[model samples]
Target chain A: MTSSTSSSPPSSSSSHSPSPSFPPKSHTPATTAAGFIKAIESGSKHLLIKRFTLRYPEQKLKFVGDGYQFDPKRAVGIAGLRGRHILYHDKCTGCQLCAITCEGIAEAIGMVRVDEQWKHNKKAIMPQIDYGKCVFCGLCVDACPFYALFMTNDYELASFTKEHLIYTPAQLAIKPKYSGDVEIKIDDHGASHHG
Target chain B: MADLEDRISESQKMGMQIVKESDDDRLMTLSVGPQHPGSGHFRFIVKLDGDYIVHCDPDPGYVHRGEEKMTEYRNFIQNIPHLERPVIHDSTNITYSYSLAVEELTGIEVPRRGQFIRAIASELNRQVYTLYWLAIYGIFLGHSTMFMWPTGDRELFIDLLEALTGARVTHAFNIPGGVRNDVPDGFKDRCLRQITYYEKRLKEYEDIFYNNPLVRQRTEGVGILTKEDAIRLGVTGSVLRASGVPYDIRKAEPYDVYNEIDFKVQYMKTADSFARAYVPFLDMRESCHILRQLLDKMPEAGEVRAKLQANPRGPPGEAYRRVESGRGALGYYIISDGTPKPYRVKISVGSFRNMLALPHLLVGAKMGDMPVIYWALNYWPVEADR
Candidate 1:
């Protein structure tokens, strides 16, 4: 429409006093056919690269350490996934710290008295979390000074009934069967989600 | 005249006066309803004169979860998860400003290393959110490849975040004291490598999406907002930057370790959809540079979290602070009455501010340019509704 169309972008960068920084831009507009062809070329280039998707259930992602657990003295987590809660019956004192911390946030954890008792747990009460409302934030794990509650990489907590979704004190005591050992590897060619 | 009653009520609710005119014969109204694929968690009404949009009205509050009011019920620390829920994908920065304001009120000093870690998480989250936005922009423009690449590239940062913060998107990582935890071992090396690879991928995005002649023709001269209108209308983030104003909250008002790290704010003189689209791509590149500098300048070892009481409280006062998020300037205003719970918490987000310019840009534009202009403003529906 105007004679200034060809050279305006670059020339204006120098003359514009307010904006000192300008991103490098390609002003030349390729033909409509070429633009479509170039987009196709870039899309096809990815066909040579490996797919990033993980086949869920068949191929679960591997996590490091023994899931997310807190180190009371260190005041930091060991670094792992925030999955289903794992209640350690031996270490639990029935303190209800986890339940107290989760009261406002999710209200997922409830203290239930177990039939069997341990010296550490005088109250015989342990936290039974309802996964239906649990956000898996791992705040409860952080609040547990006694290391009674921790999170494991058992994300498959789906159930048909709401009752089935609630993991009991006895159920939380069981260690989950999660055998995952995959990591995303970046190399010279490109990044790949690898096992 | 009964049929005209609905139109009048709608116009009055929108704060616009309706005048009965013969122009109605030439125009038809269309709603980009909440159920439409193009409008995700958002809806708007647009009147069309055949090929051209004559008037536009944005309807925002479909997903309002009363985030501000809910903050009053929960304590300052318990509210972290709730605060980031609005913009879950870009949680780090949402919580960043909140934490900064809370820290100031309590008179808590974040450790040097903690500040650096917080900045690193912020820069990484920026990439994650921008890439997600770019993906949506691509699909909106009928560029399918643009959608796939950015979505895949986003996993790189998400994986890094998973290792450090334990969760991928809703990282409740930034606490009032500092960050929740330090960067895990091998984090710097992995972050740098992925960022460099991402920089290479950015050029490919230009070739396929930005520089393509079809994309250029559709966007280059469309949705023009001059410098005066951009300022007068009070738009924030990339939309404001695209309109020839270099007003980036990061540069204009530095927060945390942003003052220490060196980077340039990307801006364009042309206030078109293309300029708006290109600004975020350039900002992503700048973020990569900032991330590297932060990792290099980071301290070797220190406490990432401050030793605050179970429920930290502040003296009776108010603190307002803002930070540059993926969209634009995100600020939090918290008034504490020397209690564990905040007296009042108000979140001033970028999406709602940018939405102010939507109607101005949409009117008199061709119907086909709707998606190009709407998304180019970098408006997130949920963020605006919250």
Candidate 2:
């Protein structure tokens, strides 16, 4: 029944090429030679152009802003890369909204009791995120109504041990210095990575 | 259904008896996937009588994370990241369907600009996903350059996506109310430039991959799914269209500015492996045109996201919405009970539906034609097993 409705063709574009039982000439020596020539010609042309690949670790792509930030009034996220979570201890109320939100999702953030006593944070707790299970979806950043949490440009969270992969509140507090300006630039030659 | 079940069971019994009898014969069983690099997180058993396959059994569920069950635990907003997990590459459309369904349940009106932006994201994701599929399909059929070009060219769209959504692969951009955020400044000019460049690069794809006689010989007339068979089997996406049905959800259903946009529903009457492959290429060309139109027609400024309560809830009801994803007709059916969490979420995916045609086509195909026939079906394994 559903198929019957969807079976009819909508308006056709000029570029639309409807096949009409046209047999493919695969074995013809002429077509085969031409196909090979054209395929090779298109491929080798890229050899003259610079490679699109970035030598990672040695070169990092520059980001636009400090990181993903949320405005309580706007009720929307500012456009930025989703990398690692950053926590501002001064702003955190220890409301556990971030922990509540992360429960069903990544469960990456764990509320750990902190040593310092702050006026804003009555619970004396902060979110310690485990990068191991975290998808970096950045929902934890969105849940922070107090503007205490946001994702930084630091994506390199790899470690030798599983225990070390978990970033403590103190570890998450430090801002990452990631810099290198690389963007995909297109020109007459072709699209290539430029820094 | 009963007759089909009986026939399958009968065949299985006969096959089991034949296996006992043909212990001395030249029948060989080759298991592809679940661990193989050639197959994505999927497994299929093919009984090869010499070079030709006598029987085929596709075993999915390798990467099944119980997504529907998981959705029950998470609320509507929290479910976005979880739902996009299945088809991570084509995350926009996967979540688009969910957001549509959720919006219906919650009654959040997406702004005009937001709808256009959502549509643009879906089309770009379609390109990203199709290029990825084409890349793997190329390598599967021994065309290494075909693999390299599309994979490289895919970055153009991925770059555009990263700028728009702030992530490369698993965007998780689409939310219940609208997209996560608006497109950044100077995005139009950059998008136009990259899209035009990508369009130019597509012609080269034709020269190397589609028009190549080597690929043609291997693909053409192999696993010919007739129009009647395609319809009877209930296949969707390019696979169904390649069998001469111009059934595009964008055209037929007309969700999110697709009704206004002018684009062709790419279909071919030949119903061969070549037709299946060619249809997506044509679709890509049309997507370029649609992207241009969408960018030109979009509003200058508007509220991209709807203002909603912290824990948004709607009255008890169910809503179902479908979108034309790269794989096929991806849909979400959500039932809400005036709560933050969804009571039930059913994902009706294209890859799973396309899997129905696998055994039907693979039973009689030659071993050499396996990859071509299989990949040409547009079956993304993770999505199917989700």
Candidate 3:
């Protein structure tokens, strides 16, 4: 497919063809006028045509698939790939697997073992996730051997106040009620034990 | 003949005096630098004769972050994201090429779903990139509406992309084996809706800008680059097509889902600035067509990511891959020494290569035509200099 071919006319063809004497005269005035008219006609036709421009924002364009929604009870509640970080306070076991796996130098997560008073147990160590440094990389969730930590699809975590971003063990343990027949218990140990 | 001889004599006399002047006056050399708005990130020293640009020399090395050199240090897996930054707008294309290079080296096969997603992302990026070009071209042509319309419309596509991938601009969607993220729930429906909206809006784009008489007058026959000239200058993409050369990287070298897609390569024989502008408008329509086809034909269930579980760890090898970007054939040449980073990464950016044809295109053109010519070339300094 790759070849070098000489397209130089062999020099003989050049001699055979008659060379123009005056650099080939410019287009005639009649031909120029005709071209202009043709251009104008085509242009006029385009302008006269109907346009389909939607005035957005003022007229809110309804996106398709607003209806026929998936029920949260029937759908698997597993947070998909881009899910935000969540901490399982009870099952944490104080393992720093998530902290070790974070790629960036500026760690967004911190695993501080704070002593907690429980009715059944004398002392319990809980982990806290600092949202300030966390990129929601989901590394910590994967590293937790006890499966105490899991990510949630609820990503509306925006806050004007910086202090509100830092999630404590109590804030991280809040679980929503099941919309359907599925009954799930949110244990104080930060683990979801499904019966 | 007398008038021509008189003008020649005057030019010669002017040239002789300049040549005879002192070293400083011999050539009033001025630098149109590595940080100028009009010149991209490239520096240019132009020797001027009065107001006329006599001779111009381009100096390019400002945003050269030693990408090629950096590649030698990073592993194959890590280089994928690094390579994507050069032409960040065309994320899929860059990452896809890097993937191809890695595949070629390791002989790994990407699954069908992976191929489809790559194509989808690349085409979407192409559409948005074309809008960016159109907006810039609009401003260059003295039509403010064209500029504003495309920029505003671009946000819609960005929103759609954000819905699919977490990030909008730098998706980092494509990795070694396949895309990082699969099409999220309701993604296809959203994409179809956007496509529908784009189809309707394309007509408005034509009426407001392409069909406008002023735009046509300013562009038609302005920079006529013949097919022969295009080939000689090594032009690719829409620039080559504008000159009647039907050479598209997608068609010439069938990569990814491009071979499967039923789309025509847009072309025009005019080879002028108008033709350049026209090619992208036609391309947007083709992109819309391809998007529709992709949605209908995509597999219902399949593996999205590649099975290559291990991240690139060590050693370096060279990989050169090319893809049809919005501007033209974007080529990436990477040299890795089997390390964590690339030893040398050289990006043959589309805009930079296309810009090479500018000085030639702009020579006989008037000063008023500079902006039009600049926009028509569609040069991105960040992509070019990177």
Q: Identify the candidate with maximal DockQ.
A: 2
Instruction: Mark the regions of model 2 whose C-alpha exceeds 4 Å error after superposition.
Output: A6-28, B1-26
Candidate 3 lDDT at B229 equals 79
Candidate 2, CAPRI quality class derived from DockQ? medium
Q: Residue B109 CA error for candidate 2 (Å)?
A: 0.7
Candidate 3 structure, TM-score to reference: 0.70
Chain A accuracy of model 1 expressed as TM-score: 0.81
lDDT of 2: 0.84
Q: Count clashes in each candidate, considering only residues at least 3 apart in sequence or on different chains.
A: 2, 0, 30
Clash pairs (backbone) in predicted model 2: none
Candidate 3 per-residue lDDT over residues A55-109, each given as its tens digit? 4324322222211112233221121433344555655665565555443322556
Question: What is the TM-score of candidate 2?
Answer: 0.93
Residue pair clashes in candidate 1: A62-A180, A62-A181
Which run of 10 residues does model 2 chain A get worst, by summed lDDT? A13-22
How many angstroms is residue B258 displaced in model 3 relative to the true structure, after the best TM-score fit?
1.8
Q: What is the DockQ of candidate 2?
A: 0.52
Sorted on DockQ, highest at the top, how do the candidates line up? 2, 1, 3
Model 2 C-alpha lDDT per residue in residues B1-386, reported as the tens digit of each score: 99966876797786432245537568887789888877788998888898999888888889988999999888888888988989988999999999999899989999898899899899899999999999999999999888888898887788788778878899888988888877877889988998878888888888878877778888988998888888888899998988888777887777878878877777888898999888888888889999999999999988788877778889999999999999888999899999999999999999988888988888889988999999999998889978
